[model samples]
Target: MYRLLIVDDEDIITDGLYEVFNRYQPERLDVCKAYSAKEALDWMSRTRIDIVLTDIAMPGMSGLELSEEIQKYWPRCRVVFLTGHSEFEYAYRAIQMTN
Candidate 1:
């Protein structure tokens, strides 16, 4: 099964994504949610995550930093950043991090 982690500081966003993923019933897809980067890190340490969908700007650690962490610890996992137009610079930085 493909494990997906949705990380967003806002409860609504995470909950909404979770519901959408669950409703779609993607082939062997398992969805998890985390409210912060730290929480997501903790979850990743315990679970095998295939994909990480996170917001760019968060409370403590940014999504870019979280992606870097995933690269180091869970190198096989893929990361997708969610950001607003105002955070385009952060999103650009996130894209650069993979390179």
Candidate 2:
């Protein structure tokens, strides 16, 4: 089973993704949710996360920063960023960092 952590400041996004993943792939994935980058780090400290789906423009630590932190500890972990922002700069920055 893969451990997936979904992080978003918005309760709805986290809850909705949690529901969808659980409903669709309960046997394949163990899904967890965090409302902030801090909470996601807390989860990471306790458990081994295989993948993280996070919002980019969070209040405290942006998803990009969180990704860097994750890479330090879990170098093989995969990060998928989610953002409502349509700005080209956000996409460009994310792509640059991943490369």
Candidate 3:
């Protein structure tokens, strides 16, 4: 089963994605939701998260900071940004860092 973590301030976005991922993914994906970056980090310390789907604009910490922190704590955990921002610049930078 693929353990998934989704972080977004918007409840609807995270909730919708959780349903979609659970319905479509071939693996028995276990999904976790965090309303903010802080909550996501807290959950990470406790559970084994395989992937993180996050919104770039968060209350306390932006997705970029959370991604960096995840790299430091769990290098193997993959990050997929889900942002409303039209600019791809942030995504490019994040992708480069991930690689």
Candidate 4:
């Protein structure tokens, strides 16, 4: 099974994604939710995360920074960023990080 960690400052987004993944792919995915980058890091320290779905414009640590931290510890882990903002710079930076 793949371990998926969904991080978002908004409880609704985090909880919604958690429920959606659990409902749709319970057998294939072990989904976890985090309300902040700090909480996500806490989860990472405890267990191996295969994938992370996070919001980019968080209060403390941005998703881009979190991604860099994740890459340092879990080089193979995949990160997917989600944001309500429609800024071109955010998208550009996200793409740049993937390269």
TM-score of each: 0.93, 0.96, 0.88, 0.97
Q: lDDT for every model?
A: 0.91, 0.93, 0.89, 0.94
lDDT of 1 by residue, 36-89 (tens): 999999999998999999998898998988998999988999999897658567
For each of the candidates, give the backbone clash count: 0, 0, 0, 0
Candidate whose TM-score is highest: 4
**What local lDDT does model 2 show for residue 84?**
98
Kindly report which residue stretches of model 1 are placed more than 4 angstroms away from their true locations once superposed: none
Q: Model 2: how far is 25 from its true place, Å?
A: 2.0
lDDT preference between candidates 2 and 4, better one:
4
Model 3 agreement with the true structure over 1-99: per-residue lDDT tens digits: 889998999989989987888777646888888999999999999999999999987888999999999999999999988888878897787778877
Alpha carbon lDDT of residue 27, candidate 4?
88
Which 10 successive residues of model 4 have the least lDDT summed?
A: 19-28
Give lDDT tens digits, candidate 2, residues 4-95: 99999999999999999878778899999999999999999999999999999999999989998998988889999999999888778888
lDDT of 2 at 53: 96
Residue pair clashes in candidate 3: none
Model 1 clashing-pair count: 0
Comparing candidate 3 with candidate 4, which one achieves the higher lDDT?
4
